[model samples]
Target: MRLTILAPLVAALFIAFTQPAQAERVDSGVPGMLFDHDVPVAMNDGAKLSINIYRPDKPGRYPVLMLMGPYGKDTTMADAPAYRTSWAKLIAKYPDLCKKSSCRYIRFEAPDPERWVPSGYVVIHADVRGAGASPGVLDPFSPRETQDYATLITWAAHQPWSTGKVGLLGTSFQAINQYQVAALRPEGLAAILPWEGAFDQYREIAYYGGILNVAWQFWWEHQVVPNQNGNAGTPLIDSIGGGKDTGLPLSQERLKDNRIDPVGAFARHPFDDAWYHERTPDGRRITVPLLDVANWTDWSTQGYLAAASRQKWLRIQTGDHLTPFYSDQALALQKRFFDHFLKGIDNGWEQEPRVAVQVRHRDGTTWRNEKAWPLPDTNWEPYYLDAASGSMGPTFEAAAPAAKSWPGLGEGLTFTTAPFVNETEFTGPVALRLWVSSSTADMDIFAAVRLIDPEGRDVTFMGNSDPNVPLDLGYLRVSHRAVDPANSTAWQPFHPHVAAEPMTPGQLYPVDVEFMEPTSIVIPKGYRLALTIQGTDFGYGPGAPIVHAKDYDLPDDSHSGLFFAAHPNRDPALYGGTDTIVTGGKHASYLLLPHVPPRS
Candidate 1:
């Protein structure tokens, strides 16, 4: 939290990177970016709403870069883990950012107008009603709140000196609302760059492959929900934003609100009903020119920029978490997109290739560009899970198999292979369909799809989250697993976790899990695919450690680093996710991957 000016002189730093004529600190005297302010706008339903504005300079007309999220925009992110991660990264990486821009004057990052101002961009950061400075009961991305966003845009476009042009940009929640508001067809909206925004609400949040992403829920309840307006964390009549705290507060009575019940809600419905569909916007409605960005190792891969590549003009890249945004190469790409779209300059960006990917390999660094996603002519290979023995079954030679289980009740079934002979490349969506049963009403079907080399070193690489955890893995929950047939294609089945149907203790039911759209990893010929099915959480290293979140502890952390909060059985055999097993056949289960062919 030490604010250091990278440049010795404020006067010197002012014009160092500018046109020299009129560069200044451009101060609004707002101590922190957390200001409770609002500009009333009209919604489609004739409802008038107010939005908080974070500006580059007060009372000036500048290009607007707007972002919205569940977090209270009226409060600064300086104290939050999510904001801290981005701030520490941004401030450290871009020393010039602290002084060169308004990073030192940051609050909630994506919506911080302070940072954008030095770059001459006006940032309209708002608290969704029921969140921060805005008024209304918080519903958190519900259909009603979305209307407020649409109205916010329409109003922002009409302000004098506005030029009626607006640009949307942000990551995660920030990136997501851009799509939702854009879908509203706000007239003043010009361009939007949504980075790694979660498109599928169910698959990304309520459940990851059916298993509830406990970390996400934990952050929501503890970190985010606690800090909203009217919460103990916010101020009432503070002169911040030069106004009163008008926004509604998050309900202390969460059960009465009924909107944030992650477990209870997800446990009720089992389909991609109107709720999920309403939350997700069709990429087609987003006709305005856009630049969608995705991280190679994003922690919350909820709002992944997967289907985005199919859009005409999207930009994809793989970087270590926040590196892409901080690094020179990626920033250059962002500048190009902004210059072309916002500045109305001919940056020659259109001539560039559509997909700018960091094609990862089993080795260290990897980068590649392409004109399309899942590039045409991709090799589709299927690796079957043969249950009779502990090897991936041959497609045709395998005879129908019966049920089998791991020794302990919750240990899970493991399948491995002898090392490969050549460098094999596998990428894209990896799907798993299993006819599974559990002794309890509900169970979590965990999968560890790994790449092992010939010597069996167990290939591991840095993931988007904790660098300690390996990247090659995905998970799912059986009760929350319900696929959207419309979105489920040949290679992957996108699950809608809106509802839950707990498992039959001993009856078979189909379980579909969608691994994120990953890279084409070239595993040497001697390498193999190791899929381990468990009844618990994943481990980072041997002896297993709980994959703790930057925020909350998992439900149950008792079993080998696995945090299980739901319920615990006293007897090891009764509650432990032991005696887990796997079975494969025409009607049972198997691994369905993009099985890419070896490229020249």
Candidate 2:
């Protein structure tokens, strides 16, 4: 068979990717950063958003670094066994990670006052609206909420301790909201530093591809429960208010008028329409200077890879979503960026490389710098699928096209490559071109790229939401496969998700599925790379620790990290049927990888 011949060539050509020579490390340390907790700012629409100001104690005017999100501004930093373990792991690898104050006072995702305040910057944190001590309804990541961010940014620039220059900083909710506000181009907004934030509401946040995601249901319910200003006897609000009322004394009946139902809205709109578009940013309109940060291991990996702006720089790290925001190297980069734009410091930031990346190997990760992303010299290699052998190789014969089917809503088919004879590495965006047919009118494709060790064990990484997760995952609703040629590249395809084109049962349709995260994986000789085509997340087990949204915890913290909701489409009647993948000849299917050739 043709498969037998190509396997040897694939092994022979497999070579490890190269790491870049080290670049100079930049650090700008100051005495300390200070703060003023629970400051309130009044919005033009007569809403009050809670704010926390962190600035120099010396009282001189300075540029403001503001973070606004649905997470309560009053949340405190505390110790946990897991967090302590993460800290120990980080410090053990990089001893200088804590060279300055550990910035221990910094809450989970907000800017650390200990670092920024001492560096001639004022760090501000605020509860957007309908959350924390802020009064109103909880309509998160909405246009109205985004406008409120702009209003708050303008408010900080005029403060007595502010220099009238402002920049945005934070992670997840704090970071993603900047895309919306930046498009509005608020006055005094100098730049943004969005770390692992989503810009597309439909594809990035609520729905993956077109199927509804229940992975964040528990997080969604608990994050806003305790922090509502009018809620009676909530510990966080009560503590901040000294046992008194936290905000305007609106009755329970009146307070109910202020919130929007996110889950209900999701159910009402199953497709990407005006509702999702309004929340998503207009990328073309975002012209602010950007220091967009992303991690190789997060769900928000797509946002960072697709980040676009006139003056933008990217910094990619290797860790879970929250790690980059807390790392010492990351903080140094953030301060250096703010210093140049906000304080007029001649820090030579303009001369810095446009892209800095962390290339991950199983043994360890190496840092590399480049002038742009997707390395200009990249050799885009395609590995053809051989359905008969359940494997991937460099070539396949067209005479015998093959098809395989599996339960549409269960563990689906997987194709693995043979053990490598030499070390091989994969970096950058990955694309799956498939010739698929579903027994039903529509199908959802969930594709995952996995690492297989020499022992045949799966090598996992820390995902944005869950620990011990696969290297990368992507999804596509077959009907939503129409591409936006104007914005899409060969390596990364852009699907508009605007209209659905249903398929006739058993009719093969060519579909492009884009894996959201850009990854760097090094496979040693005797190791393999596997691709799983499934309808759900690759699971570890039922007892895995649940990861929730920021500040996501129950009142009693009992079911704080639980995932309770099920996907609406994951049912026997709705989405359970056979799905087929065809390969060879006109139905040529392949995996597109960004293959970086090793240095000569």
Candidate 3:
């Protein structure tokens, strides 16, 4: 603390002596920057919203850039007593952005006005309703909030300073809402840079492969939601309803009413009933050019990558979730995109490739460039699941055989591979063909594909969320394997995922499961890959962060715990029995990989 106090003063002296006193003057209302006024924008509802507008004084008229978030609009560092003391430290590195255009309307998570205003742009930040000064229910990420998004874009489009071309930029929830609003097709909504956002609430937030994600959801409600309203120590000093969401304090009844039981919502609709159907972003409805960003380490949905890959203009990047927001390269890309789309500037952004992915490198740094998503000429190869030695490989020639292993705790099966010494790239989606037997009516197969090193080590790569994640895994319940043949083909495997059908004690049936898409990873010169087959659900670590819901928690059960019944909910000790044993020999099994040819 003591050193920091003297450090800035000493640095000032060093700067004055080492170089010219004025290195880069910024206009943030500081010696290096400037400020602007807080303008009020009216929403469709009676509630009013406040905006902190940032612009350069020397500009006649400039293209406007806008951001809408639940954070406060007036809560810039200019008013925070503690923030002022620490402002210089942050401003030191970002002098121009922190000081831009008199700094009147500065907010976090935005490029400094001094950086963009001089480039002929006006930045506007809006505090979402139920936050800052806007009024109404604080049900965040709701259709209501999304409706207001379209309204704001249209409102911003007509502003005197705006060119009727407004683009959106933000990360996390900020970016997710852009996808939702864009689906609405607002009149003036031009483009968007949606980064690290998942569109499906079911897969992204509520559940993963039918497992409840209570961890992040619980924390979000506790810490993030409260401040979203006019809570203490929040950014954006303005309140909803022009201070109503903040005025005379919100009623506890109203606050309580806004609380959402996310788990309960999902529990009610085990299928695509009403709740989930309403929450999912209508991707088919979205028709805007997007600079979509994604990270493998993002626990959020990678569906956007799949969604944008289908679009004409998209950039699917891979890095730590937060890297692109602050990285020079990402910012430069965003600047150029918005400059071309919103400002009508011919910045050559249109000629940029349709997809820009960071081909992951072994080291932390990534190789980035333009290419077709799923790389056009992918090799769709299939490897089978042999129920012996618990392996995954291709079936050569199938000979008559006895019944395979049971569902749970039974013999795991087998297959083989002519080990490849050359490196091969596997990109795109994966599929599985399984012939199984069961003693009961239903069965669940936990199928995971892994790369086994020549040294017999399980190869784990950075997944969409975890660095130690496996290559690819797919789940299937025997009865639920009924595919929508109309939608089911080779590349896309559509499952009904509806009811559970019991299996004949010794009947043999074929089950097909498709693994979600993953980028290519070189299998190195000498490596043998393997797949894990199990009946039990997959959960790791102290908390086991994932919880799968089953008929065991149905209305008749009403509660969750160890099961002890039969008929409907069978007793595990008796009929709940399963044969998870795997047996492999000859041409019984194999794994299919969509292999991409090595870069020339």
TM-score of each: 0.76, 0.85, 0.73
Cα lDDT of model 1 by residue, 1-600, tens digit: 000111111222112111111111323465433232555444444444445555543456666677766565544445555556656656665666556344433454353355455555667766666555444456665667666665566556666546567888766667767766666566677887777665666555555565444555565675455545556444322334434353444455742463455445554433556666666665455567777776544422333333332324544454335445544565566666766777788979878777655555655556666666556656556566666677763452254666776532345677765566566666565667776666666666666676665555445544444343333455666666677789777666666556667666776677776565454466666667778877666554444433321222223222211122243322344334333445654654677666556545
Please tell me which predicted candidate would have the highest TM-score against the true structure: 2
Error of 3 at 535 (Å): 5.1
TM-score of 2: 0.85
Highest-lDDT candidate: 2
lDDT at position 570, candidate 2: 58
lDDT of 3: 0.54
Which pairs clash in the backbone of model 2? 137-258, 137-259
Q: In candidate 1, how many Å is residue 536 off?
A: 2.1
* Candidate 3 lDDT over residue span 1-600, tens digit each: 111111112111111111211112233443322344345555555456555666656635566667777644555555544345335434543565433255554444444455666677777776677665555566666666676667677766666656677778776667777777777677677777787777766545554333344455543454345445535434324421223234335556665565455555655555544455455566666667777776543423343543433344545445334434655566687788888877778878767887655554323334545466656877777664545333344443343333355446333333335466786667566677666666666665666566565655454444433334445666565666677788665755766555546677666666775454444456666766666665543323333222111111111121111110112222354334555333344324445677777765
For candidate 1, the TM-score is 0.76
lDDT, each prediction: 0.55, 0.69, 0.54
- TM-score-wise, the better of 2 and 3 is 2
Q: Can you tell me which runs of candidate 3 are displaced by over 4 Å?
A: 1-40, 71-115, 203-205, 230-248, 297-311, 364-371, 395-419, 435-447, 462-467, 476-479, 496-509, 535-590
